[model samples]
Target: MAYECLFTSPRCVFFTFTLLNQLLPSILGATYHSHDVTSDTVCNRYHKRELQVYMSDPVILETRPESAHMLTLGLSLSCTFEMEAKGFYTTGVVSVVQSMNFRSHGDNCLDYMQTIYEDEDNDMKLKRKKSKKKKILKKVVKAAVLSRRRRDTDDEDGRGPRICGRVLFGLQVDENETLPPPFADPLPPTKPDQGVLSSLFWDAPNPYQSLVSDAAEVDHKGEIKTRLHISNRMLRQNEDVNLKVVYTAYQECDGRRVPESLFHCGYGLCISRSLVNDGLVNCPFGDCADEVDCASAKEANIIAKVLHYERTDETSVWWIILWVLVGLVLMFLACCGGIFLFMRRRKH
Candidate 1:
């Protein structure tokens, strides 16, 4: 079925990623519990018609040298619930990990062999060149790889993950099928490593390694959910890539057991505390309610006080120095006048 975009015009871009256990840990206070997928039914909408969510895996796109940076994967699915929203809402989050592996190019032996073939008359010289070239190539490779590893390690440690582009894809459930209020999904953390030298010369980190803490939860009753982990590694141009897609229907939670770290978004939705003041709009209504009146004001006040203290201290020191200099000059002038008078009296 043709899935139409809920936020904007429909586009035929598909992405596949694994849906994690509990999307919003802070919003849902209770420990994450997976639900039976057999009992729950998840459906997607196209042209106001309901259809089952289908999967098209391993979609390959060959990226050329000039246009690799501009490529983005977007998937829009309008999920329509089979049941009514009984004082609860459903949200789904998919985590994607993209890894690029660099293949070493230009074999030194092959280039040397080609050079030897060109100069067929120099048999003795070819043997000497071959022996010298092998030793030089090994040293060059070792030095380059070592330098690259050091640089890559420093870069990873010094800086946080770089976000290349914003990802905007979420479920747009109809009011009849879901809740009345429309909730906004906060931007999840993404890792976009676009290092040419590091990927080429050094081994990349394991993509499957979880950066988050190890916290697992069992399936709770009245909740239908599934957990999946996907690793997207070694992305290259003209390569047939297969993305593993795992499906997990969202769980319905009563608003009774709300966590202390959650911020209410007007009528129904609860946003995580970490998502607040993150400089992104997490609510559909009002001008970024979560970001408004954040700790930035307090920080700015503290900074202003520090600057004021520094300025006051500097001004006070300058005034004290000026006064001391003035007093010393006055004392020296008085001493000179007294000496002049004494000399005049003695001369008289």
Candidate 2:
């Protein structure tokens, strides 16, 4: 009966660990509690761990003081889970849900997580044949029932909203950091809006009391799905590793309700959220604004180190340059001496 009540009620949220007390970016000032899920906890048939959800509080995005020009109107959640796949099932799914007390009007929400590594059995991906095949797929969005679709699903029955999406991350943990060094991928940017603002209406005069009276009729919550598949080849029957899970939120009202998620390249330009770490160089070629700290980039660095192909230190580089210069000077002098001898012999 308690399980049934938890599913039926909106106020009672689920978490693996204790609550996280922190202030998230809001259109108006608001606070949120963090929740967690792990492999050991059982919730549903489709997922291995229970859903990590943000407490039912409307975090109104407001204009940050430093960036007064940018008024934020939506919230984002990032969840980190310690993953060990020894005795547990070889495959599992990790889920995170973002429920809103107010109505959300667009498809601006997307999910991302740490990258999983795939390579040959020798050591790591250090010595795979050079091929164009991608080792890991970082974007995990299999099936998502967002704002509108979720509302319709809830109407049919009093049951909780059905939320499902793509597998999050697939990993193989070993004693050695042989597992691909985990890194966060940037969430894709939302499409540009028409620069207009939509009117957001709420009931109670106090922003806090504006929470929807009926939990079943709520329309603005979404679930992010990710998967972890452990391989017997990589683990030693009782090994576990830690991985990161990230969730990004965007609100695409007609006007700029929330600022577009952008990542600063540390250079002069700010690129779209999707552009960051998408593989193709969007910012300056070597600035590494979009490429550095990415999963693929970090993995490549690790592979290079393992293969003994990493770049040499600056001192070694300068020494090589000096040797080349000295060699060039000696060759030039030898050529001059040979020309002088040839002229003298011809005259004689």
Candidate 2 Cα misplacement greater than 4 A, ranges: 1-221, 231-234, 237-240, 253-348
Q: So what's the TM-score on candidate 2?
A: 0.22
lDDT of 2 by residue, 43-138 (tens): 123533323222212111111133211112222223222222111111111122212111111432132222111111364334333322422211
lDDT of 1 by residue, 1-348 (tens): 122221112221111111211222223322211111111122223311111211111011112243222222322122212211111233322111111122222421100000000112277455646676355544555454344321122132222122111111111122232312222553222232424533432123311122211111111111112221111233345732221111112222224554565554333334444444433333322223444532231122211001011211222364367556755764565566667667777999
TM-score of each: 0.18, 0.22
Off by over 4 Å in 1: 1-259, 293-348
Ten contiguous residues with the weakest lDDT in model 1: 109-118
Give the clash count for each candidate: 1, 14
